[model samples]
Target: MTRHETFARPTIADKDFVLATDLDGTFLGGTEESRRKFYSWIEESRDRVGLIFVTGRDPGHVRDLTRRRGVPRPDYVVGDVGTTIAEVDDEHFLAPIAPLEAEIAAAWNDAGMRVQAALRSVPGLTLQSSGFRFRVSYDMDPDRFDDRAFDIVAELGLDALVSADRYFDVLPKGVSKGPSLLRLLTHLGVDNRKVLVAGDTLNDLSMLTMGLPAVAVGNSEPALISALEGMEHVHRAREEGVGGIAEAILHHKLLQ
Candidate 1:
């Protein structure tokens, strides 16, 4: 099956609304050919879609790419794993959210106090001061970091998500792509049911949970495809990188 065959477009015309997606490995490709496809998707869908970027990257990097390349700026951006929301106008401006680093730090230290702490924990698994913190398992066997790190974060009450190949991001308990996307939906007065989200990692899972409709690109982990398997509304694109993203949108008839 080709990438476009992954998701069947609904016959019913839904509201014209949101297209929220991730950046790395979704829109922008790691190589030149894929990058062009990313740009093509924007050009093809710009007028019909309310383009929003929900990414783990900082808002500045998002803006920098837009400014440097002259690509269409996202209407709304949920960045730093939902720690910052930006409303882009003539310029990209940031709206800050509550910082959760201190709380995560406190939790780690308290876990250390327990007599039977399951694993060796980092003192303050602080990735940066950028609202949320990412903690990697220090005791992880070199070959098993992904599974181990995921296990650690799963124990937390906060919104913990894994991404790329090596890290897990910790967000405020309620903040995630779904909630962040809905916030943009509310701002635009668009119906949530019309939204379509696409991505390739664990961080993308929340938006899928929104139960609107979601597309997991071909490069996405096998576990994700299995999780979404029985859901008719959830689709998996066949192409990798940006080409896959276009297939997802077109296959879902999001551009129309």
Candidate 2:
């Protein structure tokens, strides 16, 4: 049985405010004090605040973050660079929604091996050992990296994404954080106006530009900032990490 099947609570759709944020350099990015304050605030406002971690990280990492490290667990997760859509039950365990992942799986078509084989000769790319279900990720060295890797992925009919100049990912054609989040919101009857999307890298570009209110934290990569030019709905926060999230929350008046 699904972990959340027996648990009962007001779904995020019922909450007045919901935060769909990226980790690493957004929700978990800020200073210790800032993260503490932000986490404490969410713990205090449990009834009003709905949290979702939208990240490139996989489910196992999400589980460890909350269960072991005490980061406030999210009600839902749009994880694996949007390749995974799942609910985090009251017990803080993730349950993938099969229906939601149907398309992602189809697009992936068990291409991890093929992708690896094709890119094995590329320099400066070290495959990550996460054993991702729908994507293949690599630790990248920018100086020696081949830009043609992008072309290789395209030729395979998949999408290629690089973030923070440190990580590279090959995903299903057209799958990424933004579209997956939209699917989750729609399935849950969430009010888009009440949602605030947050991120600090290029992979986040898809979601930030998806018309939802968004924040590009102060420490965001130049590539991401450059892409957001003239996009008024996105707030450029002065605070780094979780601090930036708090700034955006106030800037958007989400909690007020």
Candidate 3:
């Protein structure tokens, strides 16, 4: 064992706890002090807390961050906007979510080529490099993007969601962060109540609306905030990024 593993790990009664959070304006958006504190807490309580990164980034980008950035390695990574799920430890991604991927594949077609071909004539729809087996992403001018895009997606049997005003994603009919996360929790045998989801953008709306306790940062997109209105389980934090996450953790008494 390494010297770090030689020490006794911090113990908590709630071993079932899972923190599922989005990146960008949520996990990586806080002040330096708050980020340090949050990272420190995760390091200190590594054994007790299960950390999951629910992000829109591809697995390669996620891997880069895990290797280069100071972010604490997550136990599980739900990447590609939750279409991809992998069990990761400190060094590498070890397990594949085969069943989950298969389910998504059943709904998706042609790696999104069909959707792309359908939308090829649509102006202002620039394809993003984030295309994967379950998702096809794009950057588009919402003003130029008319209902035609929606019709194309629907006709192709896909679901389209726009976030942060520019990111357009075409996903499988039932493949979204909420349902995918629920599936992951079921696979892990973890209760939904034990999991806390956090995010700050419209892309995270589905996960936030999953009826699990959630945290929306102060810097979250206005649309996301509006959508979360009247949702009793979500806590709007005064702080941004990791600070908001910390606030929500305390607000829900999740560690207890």
- Model 1: weakest 10-residue lDDT segment is 133-142
Residues 85-180, model 3: lDDT tens digits? 777755755366798778787777565777778888988789986547688898888788776898888888889888899888888887877778
| lDDT tens digits by residue: candidate 2, 60-139 | 89999998997999999999999999999878889999999999999999999999999999999999988999999999
Ranked by TM-score, the better of candidates 1 and 3 is 3
> How many angstroms is residue 250 displaced in model 1 relative to the true structure, after the best TM-score fit?
2.8
Q: Which prediction has more favorable lDDT, 1 or 2?
A: 2
Which residue runs does candidate 3 get wrong by more than 4 Å? Answer: 1-16
Q: Count the backbone clashes (under 3 Å) in each candidate.
A: 0, 2, 0
Backbone clash tally for model 3? 0
Q: Write the per-residue lDDT of candidate 1 for residues 46-86, one digit (tens) a residue.
A: 55557778887887688887888755687778776655566
Question: TM-score of model 3 relative to the true fold?
Answer: 0.91
Ranking by TM-score: 2, 3, 1
Alpha-carbon runs more than 4 Å astray in model 1: 1-17, 37-41, 69-71, 95-120, 123-157
lDDT of 1 at 105: 44
